[model samples]
Target: MSWTSFYLIVAGLLAFTMLLVCWPWLRRRNSMVQDSLTNVQIVKQRLEELEREASEGVISEHDRRQASDELKLALVDETSLQKEGSRTGVLPLSVGAIAALLVGIIVYFNVNQLDKVARVQHAIDALPRLSEQLAAGKSEQFNTEDVRDLALAIRQRLRGSPEDARGWMFLGRLWMSLGQDVQAIEAIERALAIDPQSTATRISYAQALMVTGEAAKFQRAQEVLQGLLSENPENDNLALMMAVVSAQLGDADTTRQYYEQIKNKLPENNDMLTQLAGRLAELENQIQDVPQGSELDTTATPGFTIEVSIAEELKSKLPEQGFLIVFAQDANSDNRMPAAVVKMPLQNFPVKVTLTTDNAMLPSYSLAQLEQARLVARISTDADVAPSPGDLEGELNAKVVAGQTSSHTIIISKERK
Candidate 1:
């Protein structure tokens, strides 16, 4: 049964116990009232005796009357009966009620503690957020390396043969984080193939397509998403993805409908909600022509570049981005910030860039968590701005730890279009 149901059941039992504890007292009060009426009859008999003596002339009326009044007062001051009956057993009953209440409280606390399911969910929620924190560098305020380590541990659980779809999806996202477009695509496709019914997987796939693939591929991704929506329009995950894609495609009404549903449906504390809201605002601007859309042609981007200058000793076993933006992630966390990004900038590929993870960007002596993070960067670029795009190198992920700079040296020479 649910916690609420258990609580109500306990409350009802305590209320019943309270009634039982008071039952004896209620019975005693009734008995005392009945005994009081009996005393009244005894007093009447004494008054009648005094009247008889006066009628027989055995005593003067005044003297007999005085004796009768004195007897009546004596009865009132100190009842001739050994009865302190009403005071009995009240303390024990009161003590029992307090005991019952204490027991109920103990049960409540213990049962709450025993809810293993709740604890598991709490852990799950925390794991994702911790990963995000590490990526965003929020944990830099504390021991960020620890957060990075934690992310790696969680990711490890998602691995091992007989992969969980959730695990593969997480890894795919992590690949995106490390600026490894090719790996990201592989991981995401693995997840989709594992669970085609999952809208979550499809949306993740679409994000990759939008940034990494060609226009034709972008259209195909949109079609895949549309087919999913046709199966279940109200699917919250699909609705959220469609909202952004629709806005990107310049569909105002449709995007707004999805936005409205998202406001009511998105899980509290989800990062996606904020991203969607910001995008929705931009879509509004696009449709309303509020100051009109910028004439910037991001389509001109050629691609991005990266450089892996790890200490020669630590240079091997490195992952690189080619024709794709690559992302390296903490194997344990869902974080993407601690990752590095590079642009490919050529052959209509994802902004591909490269960087060395373990040697220079990371400190000589790394924090414990970063050691396990499988250290990497993410990559992406604009198509409408080539040549220069190819020359552009991505930022360093050293920002994961506070007080660190994020600048990088030129990784590629600029080539004129």
Candidate 2:
């Protein structure tokens, strides 16, 4: 159920319960007033009886007079007692009602965790709309914070409902849009595990895997694409991806076959067709008469070249055996997972390093997919890739265009500890 609906239901029940709690006291007060009136009537009746007996000569004058006096006194005492009881009852009932209300409010707030519940509810309500927008290729149209909130909500939900395959898929795409390729891969992989036969899931998984710039991942992506294409040769998207993967793997024959199928399947006026034609031309120009090698050719790939150095003041703090880790990550994404990273000895300080799909943590993400990125260089006391206490670090942010080269410099001047 929607959080808002559940909250409202609980609120309604609480109101009903409060009224029930106070209802008995309210009825008791009215009953007490009714009882007082009945007692007064009985007193009047008793006095009338006394007067009637005196008139009828059934009792002596002194006896009748004494009985009337006693009855009057009793009535006065009863009235006083009733008044005291009413006042005493009112004070306790009022205080009890107030205390009950206060307690209920406290319980409601604590039980609901109101602030957190509201935030999670907002996220759940927004995720479907955000997914629709993203699927429409309008992700760029959303505010960055909105995107972040949507992702957060999905994660919150997945925590409780981990078996939701579609949710994982959405989360995967959302991460990709945010330039969190590693997380995207992790999410997509989860979805793939849940539903291995889903073509869409497999395709997304392959795409993410291929960007890691790792040879093994690239081969896996190629295998996935080939498997899909074998089922339907005219699947244009599948064929196109196969062509790209084959090209990356330096399999000219396979690449040409898939490229030809893609062209044949797409209409002549299709924009993608034109784009594919140009890519095919570029591939032909680059691969003519070239022999395939065990190592992929990354020279033609667009990426970044980073220059790293230790600040003069901090240089002495660097340990002789420390490892210098350099990496680039999406600048716009909150995720710290690197798109590309390399490690070297601290002796390589003041070194220039190239970052591309070749250095990707996964084959599915590389500098090629980023329009902007942050460059980081760290000197770790141990060879650990993760930054640890006392690690010296530096970073610089830069704007980059995919398929192009950019340069940036970072100086290690700050200690993580």
Candidate 3:
């Protein structure tokens, strides 16, 4: 290609890119012009409302009828004037023509430039399999070459339409999956900045921060979440996530507080309530396994291992008082013998136990009992945490059958699409 030819090609490409970039603004402006025509629509709606009110005796029938008659006459007059104006010359015709011509020319040039860039992009090949791999969360699904092509596509698309919230979100996630934390943050942050009110953007941003362990930035994410919680306190998903994040941060008190708030705000059958219970159990387990002070030895096991898994259905039913500490004991003792204390978090959960067999002196519990032990939750308010609710006794018993994986499906809440 000669210099002029090369310049023309470049110009065409640039025009194409610009046209694509301006597409959103174009659509919005068009919508705005159309929306402006709805003033008449509002008047029509008001006319109908006045008629309804007059029929229902909510307003003076005379006033309603007069208002409706006036509205009908004004609307008809307006429509007739609009039609007349459309037919006859209504403004500075010469200036309006010039302005319209200029706008049309500008739009045409931008559109042409946009078309060239799109064509150039089309010439750049990509693999269909790459999209599948990306969907499957496989970073390795695309090699460096494939990544380059995909990356090019991403950059061009972003350049062409940076304000597209979904595109930004997707690119951010892709960067995260590649362990490109900084780039992911930038992309996701840009998306949020563009559409600050979008809940999906906020969630995706929070997830990116969590995955990257930007501990310092966590407070910002938490603030965003808290703001959202304040807006919709009964939002089960938000409430559950709030509790989970609290638990993860080693704030059991805060975690429990969030859970309680969620429970109070939500209905009796909120599904996220179930997740909150599981997270509560995990927090309880961690709290129990702690050695108190920070000074610890890595070399020694605490002589035993404790595994606690709760059945899904039972999770939501777990009270805030915490898990029931179960243990095999002398069936007749005043304080039942603590054969092996089983700390189970009530969430109507199935559990697993791994006792420390290192103490040869201690008698071993058979795997048969361990495996066969059924789900038993304890919150003996009189004997449970506090603020007793039941007249039940000190202990409850259940068995878990061995070699079985049992789970309860708990469907808590549903919202229509």
Name model 2 segments beyond 4 Å from true: 1-11, 56-58, 106-138, 146-171, 179-199, 210-226, 229-417
lDDT by residue for model 2 over 115-189, one digit each (tens)? 876677788789888879978999778986687778888899899999999889988977776656677889999
* Model 2 residue 74 distance off true place after TM-score fit, in angstroms: 1.3
RMSD (Å) per prediction: 22.6, 11.8, 29.1
lDDT of 1 by residue, 25-73 (tens): 8887677677777877878898898899899998898999799989788
Clashes of each: 57, 12, 26
lDDT of 3 by residue, 1-417 (tens): 344786799689767866675565557556644654685788878988887887898999889878878877877787676556544543444456567657867887976665655544552445355667778899665665566566556766788797888778777876766556566778898988888888888877876665532223445566777878888887767766677665445456767978887777777676656656765665576567556666543443222223344445544554566554433332321111132444444444334444322211113222121322222223432232111233121323333333432332222221111
Of 2 and 3, the candidate ranking higher by TM-score: 2
The runs of at least 3 residues in candidate 1 whose Cα sits more than 4 Å from the true structure, single-residue gaps closed, are 1-164, 176-182, 203-221, 260-417
Instruction: Quote the lDDT for 396 in model 3.
Output: 31
Off by over 4 Å in 3: 1-124, 127-151, 258-417
Sorted on lDDT, best first, the list reads: 2, 3, 1
How do the predictions measure up, each by TM-score?
0.31, 0.47, 0.33
Best by lDDT: 2
**TM-score attained by model 1:** 0.31
